[model samples]
Target: MVATKGGDRVSGMIVETEAYRGPEDRASHAYGGRRTRRTETMYGIGGTAYVYFVYGMYYQFNVVTAVPEVPHAVLIRALQPVEGVELMRACRPGRPDVSLANGPGKLCTALAIDRSLDRADLLGDRVWIERGDRPVSAASIARGSRIGIAYAGEWARKPWRFWLKGNPFVSRRDGMPRHVRAGRKAGGGA
Candidate 1:
């Protein structure tokens, strides 16, 4: 149930995600005492959207959840490209199919997600997670802190990683060896 890029309707599946608790969660951008016009979205009711531009080149998507003002969000790490392969690839070319949705910015590019859809209701026709029968085993999943933000300090060590257990599509940062990244995907039978 992956969302379509061309205003075509499709459901978005929750494949791989990472949770960042506000304030207490150091890995979160809305960490304690940090607030901005951009972060203002993070302060709003959970279930809202937190889309932002990065590198002036790509958009990173995040889903706000938990109590309003709690500032918790699950970074959509990756999507399996289950429903729309051709569409995803058209938006994101030059990579293996698996790599299409492997990273945050990459996922948006592949999924055709952008700032225009920011704050849009995910439960609506344009986007949503249709129930699926994917057998994501616990053994196939993995856990670890998130990537690209060493500034998180102690929060950097939190094991908030969730992936499709043993799924090879999870994006790994550069320079990190394979054996060191063993992760267990969670919540089987989505």
Candidate 2:
């Protein structure tokens, strides 16, 4: 969940994620050990937010992972809305709840996340990850190639994307495994 300065709150279940290992992963913004002002937060300790703008418009949200200096982060690719659906609908009007936060940029827009959230502490009350009671079995997780980075060559093919199996809120459902798609068709549990 994330609370904005105006006190409006938006909450969701993180259903999709993509990993980026700085200095090693070509698709990462901090690739090749490059450390610019924009990527500095990515080098911070784990639990730090690394929000960045992309394509001159959309904001993509990521959480710094691993330890400091490692620059590892997990991109929050998709989210399932849990609270403040009306606020989210206002932000992204005309879209269904499932499609509101189904993509990285869409997730940010739905939650009002922008550059202002950069370097924000994910462990803080303003923007924290709460523990959910839902149990996710290892077998219920699916992995696939990261999206929108074919320029990274072989790195683009690495299966670094992970999502809950049969999750309707997952971004790019067409890219999911055959079994997952079948499960969704059969109305299997997410």
Prediction-by-prediction clash tally = 12, 0
Output the lDDT of residue 85, model 1: 75
What lDDT would each prediction earn against the true structure? 0.71, 0.86
TM-score of 2: 0.89
Writing each residue's lDDT as its tens digit, candidate 1 over 125-176 gives: 5555556777656775677766777788887777787766556567763223
Total clashing pairs in model 1: 12
lDDT of 2 at 101: 94
What shift in Å separates residue 81 of candidate 2 from its native position after superposition? 0.5
TM-score of each: 0.82, 0.89
Candidate 1 CA-lDDT value: 0.71
Off by over 4 Å in 1: 7-13, 135-139, 173-190
lDDT per residue as tens, model 2, 56-117: 99999998997989999999999899888888899999998889999999999998888988
Residue 15 in model 1: lDDT: 62
